[model samples]
Target: MPEGPSVRKFHRLVSPFVGQQVVKTGGSSKKLNPAGFQSLWLQDTQVHGKKLFLRFDPDEEIVSPGNNPLSEPLQKEWKEEAGHHQEVSEQSSRSPGGDDAVPSGGDGLRCLWGDTPAGGAERWLQVSFGLFGSIWGNEFSRAKKANKRGDWRDPVPRLVLHFGGGGFLAFYNCQMVWSSSSPVVRPTSDILSEKFHRGQALEALGREQPVCYTLLDQRYFSGLGNIIKNEALFRAGIHPLSPGSLLGLPRLKALVDHVVAFSAGWLRGKFQGRQQHTQIYQKEWCPAGHQVVKEALGPPGGFQRLTWWCPQCQPRLSLDEPEQVAPSSGARAPSTQSLALEGP
Candidate 1:
């Protein structure tokens, strides 16, 4: 699965193509199970998370339509701001600056820059592949859809691909909902922002709820996936089985900060604090001269996650550090006992 770094790179690569009208000269991969989308004209070109957003208007009614119900507020915000700009334009004529000072540029926000015909609201229609939807370029006939399983479809779209020439494709766990609309009101005060910055990890997840998997929780860190979780914990010297509540609020906050910083560095193909490359993730062996560890198990969090660590380089940790749970025995458990990892 792609991590935040890879997703950020995708956004950077595809965002420039927004608004370009294209057609599906070819079709999607046959290996991509449920081969629903193909040969459709694409419009509303946009990119969110890593998924590309383009609406396919069929000559006939579209079969599986995906929409972002959460983006309504953002749409409302944009409309209200446009209304405000129009109001300001009308009032400015009465002011001393008059028409000379008020100039309308060709685009909505660009009007303030100079005098030109203001372009009407630029509207775009979008088709999204929720968490696991993807599209490929015309050359990618054999390219696989990132998500074939899971409820990648919305309430309306279980199966059925937009048959057109042009659409967007992305990898596992992209954040398409956030790009659907813009927020109406800008931040008027710093209080809410400060509070959120101080306590962002525990906030309600936008999606992918009812999961204990630390890596999949967007609340803890936006754009993290399985790869990031496997590596980040190893780098931070924490066990994968550690619970969020047991990580302690301060350590959790530190971890969040570390993730954001490290993700940025990783995307740039660099390491977080150290100028050197990664310390241990996906490497041949432990850089610290210890045997690299690997485990494949159905973790308590849910997924059959992979974990890697070094016993000699990564010091043994006490269970009290993460508030270890006692095995299912009829004995009373201690509130603060120091438990040890079994020797290799």
Candidate 2:
């Protein structure tokens, strides 16, 4: 599953499509009818934790040929190619005021060309990605080579958005649903948000649950996943199974700080097209030359996720023992505190 940083990257990739009209729609998603999205304007794009939201508003008129943003040659090629492959829907031919018309609203539409009239109902699509889910802009995933059985393997996009500007967006292995209400996102709890409240995250880490379990709780630490949990704990030299309440306030603060810093660093690496170097997540040894321990850890009756840590570096703490902060030899990353102040 993609973490917060990965989701934010997807948000950035799809942001440019905002204000483009959906010339056509195709995909294998049974949960959403793509036909209704045709002619709707891509009003806004937002990311909240592991989810992405796209707002589409109904327009009274479609993009005229004279006003089309794509150049004449490119627009002609797209129309010719799209006509051959794209799914032709009955709703595509219907007038904007027809019975299946989507509702529209005035707020959030930022047109790419000029002013757009907005009064009809607006629709929101909430996208939740599964493991290995991804979004491709202006392209489709290539078909894989045949397997041992000589069976050709080709994956269909879950949602495909063909824009009027001759570009398209393809989504794979993701869930799409039309939402009636705005998505509820708490910026203060989101790890990637500028409004991330360190004090609040520290308080959440003080719960009685296992530290690893608390770290994965989206209610408190939005955008955090198993990867961030493992790496941050290793960097902070904290045991995964230790009770958060047993960890002293200072220790909890350190864990929070590491989480924020690591998330920001990970996002930065993604933007720079650099691969992330893991300390102990799937490694056999820790940076301090100690054998890493791998085991599933979670709260009772909760989901157990695989976690890695070095026993020598992250010694388990007992309730009776005095709190001791282990020295971390892990490489330091840029802190997110300054980034948060600068705003997202």
Candidate 3:
């Protein structure tokens, strides 16, 4: 799945479409009838963690069916599919925050459209990318090479939006839903946000859980994923399985600082089109020439994720040992790169 940085990049890609009217819509999504979005103007775009939100408002100038270029058969299909759905306003009213608005049963196609709001009230489309999901602008994804079976074809976009300016956006392998409210609860929790609260992150880290599992918790560190978790832990010279309670305040502060620095640096590198070199993630050796260990570490009965660390560099800590921070050879002096880029 695309992490926060990657999702932020996607937001940038689709930002230009804001204020543009949807001239046409086409996609293979059985859940969402793309035709429902036709004639709507994109109001704004936002990113929270791994999710993208697009606000759309109805355009005043409605296009008549005679003038629309969409084929009649396709239009008929859209009407038929859209008929069975309820209004988004009705669904959202029953489930505030739009969290449970999507029905757990049926085809899972909880698409619902309502009458256009009277005073330019906006409807939102929330996008959540699956693993390997992505969005593209003015182009479709190219087809992969044929395998031994000698079969290959262009990938079908899960959703396509043709804009009035002749440009278009394509979504592949992503979940799109009509939402009534913004999903973000605490904006400051996002690592990339300008208001990211380091103290809050430290407080959350103080919980009695494996540092690895706690780091992955979205409630505390929005937009943080496995890559950031692994790299940040390595840079701080902390083992993944170390209990947060065992890690002292100083060490916890160091870990928090490293996470912010690394996340900002990684995002900066991405903006400059530079690839960040991994010091320990998926590596055979650490910078100090210590062999790296890879294991799936997590709380008992919880989902386990692969973690890589140098045993010599990031030794497992126990309550018996006096608190001592290890120096990571991979560590650098505290950076100001994070200050350079203001959060979105």
Candidate 4:
């Protein structure tokens, strides 16, 4: 899946469409399962971590088919598979701060759009490109339709957003939603941000749990993904499953620093016409000639993701003895990168 930096690129691509009046709107995804979306004017666009949010004005003008221009095209697919009329639940859309919105039930992506606290109203289309999903915007004149499996029809778009002026934005293999409890607003700082919260990162990482667990926690690094975790840990010379609290401050900080640097480097690579050269992720051998080890991990029963690292580079600390200098679950250890590796 494309991570936070990639999602930011999508935001930039469609931001120019802001203020355009939506003439017809509708699409389908295996996960989104949208009922249908009515045409409304576009307002704004935002990117938070790996999610993209599109804002629309709520003043929808429903007109008679005879009087509507492109009435045929607009309604042709809005009712495509019989489930027309996607709506935001009154409870979810109207919630203050949107914390109560549940993210688990429907689709790979979720959105919550409705009345803001100040009485102003807005509807949003939120999307996340899961492992293989891709989003692209093309002109209406060249748009193609989608087949039953969400693949692009000969020349029609997989998802079409027709505007009042005969222009359109076409999407392909993407998941979009308009009702979710997940907050749509982004936090003030993403992990790669200039104002990164070292205190918060440290607090989030200070634990006996696996180091990779904290690295993948959205609360700590909103944009961090599996690939990022592997690369960042390898760069910091830390093992993925090593105990977090045992990585003395200096080692922990090194890991945190690489996360931000590698994240920024990922984006920079795109601009430079290539991606960052990963050392251990998905590889069988490390740069220093050590056999790379792989692990499958996650919360119990969940689908495990693959994690790769050179065990020789990222040595785990022993949890057994007080003589070993491992911190107690609540104790903060002093900074040092030369701590002895735990014996396997």
Tens-digit lDDT track of model 3 for 1-344: 56676776677677767778999889887777788778888877777666677777785433222111112121122211100111111011110112311223333433544333335545667787766677888777765566356756666777899999899998887777765443333556677666667777888888777788888877678778778899889888888888888888988887877777777676555656667777888899988898889898766766677889988888888778627656666655456544432332
Q: What's the distance in Å from true for residue 14, model 2?
A: 1.2
Worst 10 residues of 2 by lDDT: 92-101
Pitting candidate 1 against candidate 4, the one with the higher lDDT is: 4
Model 2 misses residue 58 by how many Å? 1.2
Report lDDT (CA) for all predictions: 0.33, 0.66, 0.67, 0.54
Model 4 regions lying over 4 Å from their true place: 24-26, 30-38, 58-120, 139-158, 163-168, 179-189, 320-344
lDDT of 1: 0.33
Q: What stretches of model 3 exceed 4 Å from their correct place?
A: 60-120, 144-150, 182-185, 339-344
Tens digits of per-residue lDDT for model 1, 229-333: 555555545455455555545444434444444444454342122332555565557655666777753444544655565555444435465433321111112
Indicate the residue-level lDDT of 82 in model 1: 7
Q: Once superposed on the true structure, which residue ranges of model 1 sit more than 4 Å away at CA?
A: 29-52, 55-198, 202-212, 270-277, 297-301, 313-316, 321-344
- Residue 213, candidate 1: Cα error in Å is 2.8
lDDT of 4: 0.54
Q: For residues 258-298, could you state the per-residue lDDT of candidate 2 as single tens digits?
A: 78778776766666666777888899998889898899876
Superposed model 2: Cα runs more than 4 Å off: 60-119, 143-152, 328-344
Candidate 4: C-alpha RMSD to true structure equals 13.1
* TM-score pick, better of 1 and 2: 2
Best by TM-score: 3
Instruction: Tell how far residue 13 is off in model 1, in angstroms.
Output: 2.8
Cα TM-score per model: 0.47, 0.78, 0.79, 0.66
